[model samples]
Target: MTASSWLLVAFPALGALILLLAGKRAKAWGHLLGCATVTLAFVYGVILFFAADTKSTVDTKLFSWIPVSALQVDFGLRIDALSLTFVLLITGVGMLIHFYSIGYMENDEGRYRFFAYLNLFVASMLVLVLGNSFVTLYLGWEGVGLASYLLIGWYQGRNSAATAAKKAFLMNRVGDVGLALAIFIMFKYSGSTGYAQVFDAVAAGKFPPAAITAMAILLLLGACGKSGQFPLQAWLPDAMEGPTPVSALIHAATMVTAGVYLVARSREIFNATEDGRLIVTLVGTVTLLLGCVVGCAYDDIKKVLAYSTVSQIGYMMLAVGLGPVAYALGIMHLVAHGFFKAGLFLGAGSVMHGMNDEVDMRKFGGLRRKMPITYVTFGLGYLALIGIPPLSGFFTKDAIIEAALGQGGWRGWVMGGAALLGAGLTAFYMTRLMVMTFHGKERWKDLKSEDGRDFHPHESKPIMWVPMAILAVGSIGAGAFFALGHRFTEWLAPSVGETVEAHHLPVEAWVISVAAVVISLLGVLIAWLVFRRDVPVERPERVSFVTKAARKDLYGNALNEAVVARPGTWLARALVYVDNRGVDGAVNGLAAALGGGSGRLRRLQTGFVRSYALSMLGGTFLLLVALLLVRFS
Candidate 1:
């Protein structure tokens, strides 16, 4: 089993390498390799989950990675319930996405490169979850960031894709700095960066209040970057430039969740610091509202989902902010969101595939008749996302809300209210999307020529539908894992013993559950009333100011341009000017001065015979005078 655990990391990486070597000539082989590798990884995750001892961390040291007098690090794997859960998600959901990519990316010329990056992403994510030490984890962390940049810019010919990829990379680099600083602080304070050792030291309360606050804040910054929170969130929506499968994997299942996982893994430090917890809660609340607002305005199908990813990440952050019970709530929401969100992205892909690459929902209408399977599957996922009753999102979302309300005070209430409002907005935008894309009159007049030959949109192939169906089932039933909450808590008890009690709540859990359902329904009603009315759709110029604001994402992008981009560009230009004039000019002046002096010295070397004789006579006279003076002395 220990050997098998290593296989989990090796398989996808091996697959990626093979695909890279084979390149475009082996496109089919690339997909096959990617699917096979992740499938084996998912099976290994299932085996490890059941076989490993749940009560403690199962650390398997393969070798010593770093050895120093002051610091020692080992290459090892950690297979606890928490790690196992994420492993299953990354490999299992990742494999499904890989299979879906075969059909979705079939028309593209660079299919092999696409699958190669996907395989690499899977391998890096597994390394991230399985790593037992901070060093190993950071390796995986940066690896995923690299892969994200590569995949997002896969369509390098498109300027938007290249720009989006750069944005994602640069933003994540900011978070990476915070994470690196936190790791250093942990090693300095706790004497080790191993999860078990550092956590144990933290639980023992060896660090001061200030140190604890700094560590938590730094880790939170990393989380903010990876999870798309607050100011750092500007990159995610632009990340819609990538292929749908890439978006589904990075935004939904794997990379973004790294932040939530980091905070949860470091719960001990956070639980000890009030300021830290407050920061987490505040950031989460802000991101949730921001994402929801922006999501409501976008008509582009993938951009809407991208913003929703930001919003859902906020919900998870809220769970972490609430403390211990929120951790489980966050994890539960994480699992459920993974299913529905991935399903939603793939469904969008199916629509794009059927419409011959059309993604603007405004350009689509009456697609339900043509793409019935996609409509049904996507609708199911959307319901789950909106927190509709009996779906996976409802149960998990309510738990987080309950934890927030029960946790006490005005902050909790404010965050809880914001979360609920976000939920309502989620339904509104998603419904708007569904109606405009699938429920209206046919918008595409080019579907047929003037002769009126059939040019109808067709259903997606079985490969695409299979993953959507699997994810749809998970979206409906994933909330059942909440029933095993006690078992999960027990398994993680040793690592989080002291803070585990912080998760326990005595309030009426059903109250929040009921409220969430009612609110979701209300959102659906509002969407229907506004978008599904008999009145014709108004032009943008004719709409109200508020509607226009919502349509333009509340001018969020404009705000970002003003606040982030303008200043950054000005600063960069200023530095360039200073370097050219101040630094380079100074160095060039020094070189010119030395050359001038050397030129004067060169004149004395005149090669003429008369000049040489005069110099020799002068030299002889000087030598004779010096000898006479020395002799007299």
Candidate 2:
């Protein structure tokens, strides 16, 4: 029965292969088949999740993927707490998103292809999590990257979608390089890429601190790229160019957090290196703020939600970065965040469906009544996201905050303050989104679509709202279920390592928790009060500097262009110039000199017998003169 776990990936991969090869011939039923693949995977994942316990780990080899001298990489699936958790999340949320897309993309001509791509995305993520070696993981990692590029650019005719897809692919490539290099480092140092072997080697102190830190940082780079952390995060918001269900599937529940999974899974490397752990903490702290500030300035509902995903993922990263102390917390937040964020994205999709696909929240007002189902489900997700009590966010996020403050010094203060600040900003932006989108004055009296059809926003169909409703329930109940007795964290202990309570807390846990709640409520209150009605749908030219900067993603794009992109471009040009002028110049110059000398020397090949005789006479006369001079001397 456990061996049947291979079916988890096979089902979806086969679905993708069939739909892709069938092309237009299978359009009508392919979408249904695609949905079935993931549904079956989810069912299998559930079975595995329950059957497996803390110590239950099964590594089943399918075939020998790479078997070289002293280097063996197997195409193996690891069934354990860590991989199984991701499998369930990927497949379960995936199945719901697939079902929802049936309605979301019903009118699109390429709906079958879209489902096929989505299935492949899930299959690839499962491969990534279940992989037994770094090589196997890289295989799945690249697969997910390819599948996502396809999904993000599903609207082949749209230039924005095409550009977004390219951006996603290029940015992710940067991370893939990091992952590849890290694997190389592991093989160089440990002589094996298998997780158990690498972990054992490291535990036996086979590697130096520098090597550990280098590998950790390299892996961090990969995480940053996939998870949309700083420096490599600019592409995520633009990912909204894809369909809403894609946003829900890839951004929220699955692909974006592959980095988190990588870090969490590679916990031993990070734990052994102090600077590496702190670096992870710093990246998470900074990116969370970047995400929050950016989220507040976006009027595009999808972009706002996109930034929200960025910020939430930061919380997870921060938790994992807390080293062994909060690995479970990170996983907990990740699971809870998955529920609420997916619901939020799907709910946003519902809003788009009702409002003729208009994304600007300023154009959406009094929609709470018009789209009651969306409002209710989205509202629950909203509360959960903002960390309201009894919701998933509160349970999972508060644990992270409390853990941060528990670090017991200025370190705790700095990281905790950053987390708290991000939380407040999150609430503010999300409340602004809710108010402007659902509770403000009617702003759609003259709204029109691209086709010039008048917009009369209405509720989404049952197919769409049903999934949103289910996810909403998860967002509501997941926190309590997971956090009540520390059940989820305890369950995750065998994999992430047991989290001993942080006894070195700088402040009382209750005090920190209270501040978090108050700060969140404060943000929510101010946003609702400030933006209860009449938002400017059109871009304002005279906004303040913060708004301006944030609207441009806090000049993150410009900064990257100046610091990374521009410098990199100039360096590439310089390298090309040097290669052509310095290296190639020498070779070409030598070749030219040889050619010129040969051309002049070739003139001496005058083939006439008279020329030959004249040369011989000159040589004979010079020889006699030299002979006479030598004799006289």
Candidate 3:
């Protein structure tokens, strides 16, 4: 049955193809078909999860992809602990998101098309995890980008949706260059692109330290783009312009986590260079604070959650960046995040569904009476996100916090401090969201949407609530299930190696956990104190500089425009100027000179007998003079 792993990708790919080919005709059953495909894949993945053991990695070859004497690349599936873990996460959460979409998109006319795009997205993500070679992974990598572009731009009539999709595509392309170059380096050095061959070569010191470090850095670049870390993070919040299910799936469950998977998979290369690991850790730390600071200033509910994801993934990046000691910790947080974050996004969707699609938290108040199920589920997720005990976030995230502090020395102090502060800010913003949305006065009573729609909040359908309920449970319990007795780290040991701390701890683990929980609760308390009163419908203009900066994503977009976009534009224009003035000028000048000389010479050919005789006489006289001079000499 493990040999039949091809069926995993085939099911969803086939679903997408059918939906596309069937077109409008598939509307009757397209969503059902889409859900069925992912459900089947999830069921199969569960079977494989139970059947596979810790130390065994099964490589099932599909065919000879690029057969050559100089290089060989086989298309194959790698059924290992790492790949299998991602497969289950992608398919399992993907199945729930699909079901939620069926109800969320019930009224939209293009629901069928949306499901097709979802299936394609899932299929691409599955291949990204399952592929045995970097080249194969690139194929799925591009596929996921395309599918995301399609889905994010699904509401083509909306200018924001179109622009957001373009922004996401362009930003991801910047990172993809790094991935492609890294693969080229791998092929040039190892003469193969397969994971086993490349990892083995790195292990045997076949590649130089420069090459290893370069690969590690380039891979991190790719991860940064896909995972929305640091500089490339501006696109993530904009992506919420798509459907909420798209937000839940792409941001929370599958696509954003691809970077963590990449870093974890290439553990050998990073271990070869201290600089590479430190850079990853630094990027994670910077982005963690960036996301937390910005998340605090958002009035839009979805954008708040989006920035929260940026910060949480930063924790995962930080954990993996710690090397063997915390690779499993990173992945464990990733899984737990998938649960609570997806629940939060779906809960946001539920809020929008009930509140006539208002996204500004300032416009929402006293909605718990109208949306009890959504409130309960979203509150649980919020608790999990704020690191309340017994919840998944408390377990998974606290482990990363402890690991960061365990790095020892000034490095530990810096990163661990950032992680702790991020937890506090996360609670503040999330609590601000919860209070503004579900408590306080009923702000929506007097408000009318831009579309002139009055707010009438109600519970979402069972289809939507059921998925949120299940995820809420996971949000509450997945951390304990994965972290208790070191189950998660040990399970991942076969893929990432043993979790051995290289540095001594600065303080006890319990000390770090206690500090984190206290800071988190303090954040929640401050938000409540501030927002438990009335929230004005319009944002105040007389805010501090920090508030203004946070509202603008800390000016990340402006910096990119100045540093990358404007410079690139000027360079392109300069190339065009040179092409026209220099290259075209020379060629055009030569042609004009030839044309003028021919025009002057044509006057001598007057097309008459006298003109012909005079030209012949001149040519003869010149030839005779030249011959006489040579003979005399």
Candidate 4:
């Protein structure tokens, strides 16, 4: 590694520190500084992406972090093809978000604090991607979680914002426990938690099958919590309480993807355990289907996107379970999703800005005439998300489907079928969102304000528009990289050759691609027919009970409250009561008894020198008589 690699981490951290220290007095400068820092980091990322040897690890040790008799850890950076790809995504897309935040948050009261948190988020994500050891990676992991909580709750006055932040933090702690446990297990089995050493041990088959499976599954638990998979997914939909830029950052760019990154990083161990792989596939399938179902029910624009994030992450998880080909497909999807999702979020933010904070699609209409830039960019993003042919999502989603089908069994068909259905739902909901929000007549009728002035909507400033344009371009064109899939295979050949076979079946590829396009178009047509002709937003409520159940996420929150929250609360209360009444009461009672005995003894010694002397004399006379009697006997 070179000095440029260190710059990637240092620049953003320094920017965050500067913005934090300067406070609101330097708000404009802070935004510029933040954008500049990420821009520089992105440049370095690109340089490294082209210059570095894709097959080898670029290691740079900064210093010794922990030294002990039993363990040692170093602060180091590793740049491989996978890490480099993620770095580019984080920095490149991160710069766009930062640039967009400049306009999105221009009028906010906590502008400086917002920029500070944004820069800190970028710094922590860089640490997460660059770290060479599990200890370092975990440090960055928790750091990003903390930053996410802070950003999500930036509007401290709002109770919902604080609640969402707390939920995100608490849910992530569940995953953190699994991650920490997995680290301990890895150390116990491999004697080292460094990525290099751990991979070496696994390759040599030093660990038992049971141990490997346990570690992999535990790690998957962590992935589930962080990636917003089922059961732990409640926090994400609520996370929309934050600023829209923050939603773009956390949900689209940085925080949620960490779990997928972790699983992909630990692919060797996961591949060794069939049970673990099956669990990953099942979870991905369920999350994919569930997200698509719930996303269709919501009218809140950002919430729709949040559920879509869950659904897309499900695709990434599915890719991981399919082995190496699928793993790369997952990463590919991650990158492409970052582009379009971030663009979609920013577009939503632009809409909110135009409508004076109106987020319900029912209240918005004919926005295509008012905000053409946002409409075009967001429409392109939606198309990409729905996996239209020649778009980025198509290539990545196609790769995953092909990998699943190649497995050639009922399992493959099930997972592949679920993914195909998810694609259709993605198209339907996104199209519904578009037509409802942009295609109909203006729906905002009431214009009541304190000043009694009429409300009018307008477009966002250029700062926000430019970033959307850049991301929209990426969403349309980034899939061209898949045309060089053979090259990618060659580049990754050395690292994953043993477990993954290289095969390109033209018939399989074409079939999956054609099927995806057909399903997507079907969804689009259904949405267009249902929503486009309707004048006043009348969605039919006559649906099956099972459909309604799926629409409400199967009442997941109720189940979580009953099964997880209630038991956890009761256990906590029981422990607290025992500590206060049982343990503390016993200790206080013993102290009181000892004090009472001491008081009695003090009274017995009460203030008489003559009494004390007489007692001593009586004791001496008794002792002498006893001694004389014993001698005579």
Reference-based lDDT, each prediction: 0.84, 0.89, 0.92, 0.85
Question: For each candidate, C-alpha RMSD in Å?
Answer: 4.2, 1.8, 1.9, 3.6
For residues 338-401, write the lDDT of model 1, one tens digit per residue: 9999999999999887776666776677889999999988998998899886788887787677
Candidate order by TM-score, decreasing, is: 3, 2, 4, 1
| Sort by lDDT, top down from the best | 3, 2, 4, 1
Q: 1-633, model 3: which lDDT tens digit per residue?
A: 778998899999999999999999988899999999999999999998898774778888999999988788899989888988899889988999999999999988888889999999999999999999998999899999999999888889999999999999999999899999999999888888999999999888889899999999999999999999988999999999999999999977678999999999889888888899999999999998999999999999999999999999999999999998889889988988898999999999999998888899999999999999999999999999999998999988888888888888899899988999999999999999999999999999998987998999999999999999999998877966965758877788888888885356677777888999999999999999999999999999999999999999999999879988899999999999999988998999999999999999888777799878988899999999999999999
Compared to the true structure, candidate 4 yields what TM-score? 0.92
Estimate candidate 4's alpha-carbon lDDT, on a 0 to 1 scale. 0.85
Comparing 2 with 4 on TM-score, the higher-scoring candidate is 2
Candidate 2 per-residue lDDT, tens place, 1-633, comes to 667778999999999999999989877998899999999999988887887653766788899878899898888888878888888889888889999999999998888888889988998998899998888888889998998899888878999999999999998998899999999889988999999889888999998888899999999999999999998899899889999999998776778979999999999899899899899988998999999999999889999999998888889899999888899899888888888889999999999998889898878888998999999999999999999898989988888888887787887888888999998999999999999989978788766666787778898899999999999998877976965767887778888898878767767788877888999999999998899857776767898999999999988778768987789999999999999999999999999999999999999789999998998999999999999999999
C-alpha TM-score for every candidate: 0.90, 0.96, 0.97, 0.92
Residue pairs with colliding backbones in model 3 are none
Off by over 4 Å in 1: 445-455, 481-508, 534-539, 542-565, 604-633
Number of the candidate with higher lDDT, 1 or 3? 3
